[model samples]
Target: MTRQKWTTEEQEVWLEERKPAFLIANQKRCAAKSFYPDLVKEFRDKWPVPPVTQAEIDDAGSVELATRVKRDKYDKRTSSWYPNNTRTLSAHGGANEILKIKSQPQPRKLQAWQAYHALTYESKWKPHVNKAWTTYKEEWLAEHPKEKPEKTRLEVMVEFMKGKFNEENDDMKKRCEEYRNPEMQAVLNPAKAKPQAAINEAFQSAINLLPRTLATIGESLVKQTGWNITILAGGPMPDTDGTILTYLSHSGKTKEGDSFDKFLGKKDYDDHVLCPFEKFLHASFSMDGEDDKEKEMDDEEWKKQNSESEENENQTENVDQTKNGNKKSVGGLSEYEKSKAKNIAQLKLVMENLNENYPFPEDLVPKPALKKPAAKKEKKEIQQPVERRASMRNKGGDKDRYVM
Candidate 1:
């Protein structure tokens, strides 16, 4: 029977699933097969072949055999299978290549490569690096060129232990391997461990002093001056241990403590203790003054001037009040003098008014106490209310009351 030709769709499907090794296997008997002519010729040159069937070529066993051969050859390169120069691969240097294969120390029961493969599938690690085992292994080999390429982290650790202390039958080959783990190196080296305690103590001391220093400074400034200074405490304390570690960290000082939640519940009761004397010295000069004696004299003179001016103002005010009292005081008129003045005014006014027409009211009659106007003047009404008028009518009330 004549074979049916594959349709375009069937040809596309064949290409998609085609394997070079399978195609090469089939070319011997299936001369009409169009796929992989170059691959068939290449495989035939590399491996001797008797007549092979298409069915046998498609079988997975053939592909498995090809893969195993390739893997075994690759394994040989990374080992001492050939001379060092002859075995050199293009990508991996020969010495390093062999090291990569054997570097991973084996578990007692399993080889290092087997341990790596098993660990890759282990439930804990599979999530981080799942099917990309080849890429991960390549990258690990690149970083740890000095490390045994075949060792797992755990296996490397064991070998590390044996090399360090196992001197009786020390394996020189194992000890030559270098593992460059910075963290591990630090732990292994004794010199790195000594200063760590002092560093830790200093850090603890600084953290503990942060709150106490702030509170003390705040309380001292308040007691010295009446002005209530708002000390913002969210930042490092100013001049803590007399060190200028930083300037103020808090924003403008605020009355609301809720704004500085980090610095809550701190206070101090001590009298103002100055930040250490070293803080005041800007190189050689003191902040308060270079010459203490001169500064003291200046301060004393300033105080004396303020005191004298205040006393002078008080004395001048008292003298002005005394002069005002003398002006307000007037002697009382005599009763006899007043009566004689009234009689003389009555006779003169009667003689002068003999030609006047009508009699005036009895209360309207002139008295010596009444004064006559020298010329015509405009009369103004007194504006005081009745209560004010009544108060003003009393004699002692005028002297006791002061007007602005």
Candidate 2:
């Protein structure tokens, strides 16, 4: 099949997708020590390569300067010019400024030369250039026959169709087996080596290939399972969460988010002090003893294992963290404290690496204020001349006393 010419396409589209490939064949024909201005001008006029803009050059210069002047210890250290930068982003640059194009010098955009070339280089010139180039090549080959190699009929040079996988091609399996490498065999399972086209066809076999919306799925589910499921949603309970809750109430309807209520429903919880809030009606995936089990593990060299406090409050949540599948203690720090510390460390590293000169925020670590202990209440000496007992006052303004 003949390749479709880009020049034959619509004027607007071809103009937009303007890519010029010049043949520098004439350069070889020039005299040994002589400069060819006429020859250079001929090709230059036909396939004009425009010079880059001053703005582009300036950007490149700035990038080069920034590269040479990297974030060093002198830039970071507390000096008259450079302040002590602990953590800041502005020292490096904004997200846009840090981009590949902004940080590193980029090649000029197509529009840089398109305006000048599009007006000058017409679509008709493509044919003329192709013809002239072809003629010059033939003439050169004729003049120097030795430059062109003689053709040979090598019997092994048979063309084979290298296209999409055909089931009928029995030779493909043999060829695959012959060229099978250990690396490929280790990576791909032969049992599950069905073609992607087959899988695609199998997946799209359904009558209705259009996406099934939430409502459609819900309807289908209702039909499948004859359960009259009232999708109680909205209010404090997030509707989008898709939480499935099943309950039988002894009283009135349950409130939003929580079903537990004295009047509505009573929850049977093992009476304990400082117990983690366990929702009875919830995903039972974590109800197993695995999550509840906490071992005294000190994996990190710097961090100390939390010695079990006499107070049962330590047994509550936020005791251990499962970060990236590694169950490690948060050094007895709360989530907020852990996040703040992590942020500070990250920012500090960035500051040192990027040579940021922004001043660190003051008073991040709050001062621990001393709390005064409360004084005990002193017992008042209540003495009567004769026998007396503690007197009781009633709401009716009547006083009753027992004789001692």
Candidate 3:
């Protein structure tokens, strides 16, 4: 049985597809570095060796010539075989190069480049990336101690990228706002706000006044210490009520009786205080400057007292243990007899090594006197104050009172 060649019909279809097929082949050859311009020309010259047109031949002899032309030019050769060629594609040797022309660099969106730059070399972003790297690597290893270094690095990078993008895009800022106080929010609104028009009202009405509130702090510090101080007020002053409450509540000595309300002479400031109008403005703004030094001192004192109380308790426990051991008699032996028996072992060791330096005096010593046991301090349960009876009768212009 003879294998049939492609008919004219099959050949035509193959011919039509040749260009794109050739391009694909060329790409593979180029990737393999076997398809230079010279090599491409040689390949085109060798393979698509176009057939002699039917119009070029005119008779039976020419038809025989065409058959001969097809056989000699394509069918007879095993190299670069395709549709009409007898050789199988898989049997043919592949081009040395498999890739085509260098791929044109893909066009990047501005946002993508911005992100890449932030990742690789941005100075400001480097610190955050470094921080993420340190935290993730340590935590990942701590959680998955047996993981390989290569796997751990990849995992760390994934978590770090997630955190980095969230922080850079202001997601962290939004989260921080959830925990911010109402008074702080009022002052921070302008800083967090966007656009000139939307923020203008919040800015002018609230944020703009922060400096004035801060200035009053400096004024108060000067009044207190008579020395200049640097003020770092980041935002606008609080509202009037917030200001007044802050001043009245926090100003003046924490010790009894020197409160801001009393110092300013709430009822008769016009005569009692020299500068009534200035005091009113200062008090109105609620600008009680922070005294960190005083707070630190108070904390130290509290810690000292707690430490002392702990030491005293430990000492009392030691004293009680000694007293119990001394007074209890075991097997009818007196307290003195028990002490002698305890030292008997040590005395024997001394005798066995007479030449060795003695651990204690030649005379067998008694254990030191047991301390007196501290009296067991009984805790008295506290009694709540008794409620007084309410008077139903209305009295002339007097408010209700209760006795302790």
For candidate 3, lDDT tens digit of each residue in 186-282? 3434444356555555554543333233334444443443332333222122322222111111222212434323433544422222222223333
lDDT of 1 by residue, 1-404 (tens): 84553324643343334444344544454523543354334434544343444554465368666555554443343222112323336455542242111243542443333333333224334443433445556788799967756746555444433433344233432222221233332343444444855765666455444322333343334333322233322211122322212111121122342212122322210001011111222222212332221111233342343234335443432222222221111111111122334544554554344325224334335445323443233112222332344542222211111000
Ranking by TM-score: 3, 2, 1
- Can you give the lDDT of residue 49 in candidate 1? 45
TM-score of 1: 0.14
Assess every candidate by TM-score. Answer: 0.14, 0.15, 0.15
lDDT of each: 0.33, 0.28, 0.37
How far residue 133's Cα lies from its native spot in candidate 1, in Å, is: 16
Candidate 2 lDDT tens digits, 63-159:
4444333322222211111111222475456533422212435533433123222222243233544555556557767888668523211211110
Note the clash tally of each candidate: 8, 0, 9
List where candidate 1 sits over 4 angstroms from the true fold: 1-151, 168-209, 212-272, 275-404
Q: Model 3 RMSD to the real structure?
A: 39.6
User: Distance (Å) between predicted and true CA of 268, model 2?
Assistant: 27
lDDT of 2: 0.28
Question: lDDT of candidate 3?
Answer: 0.37
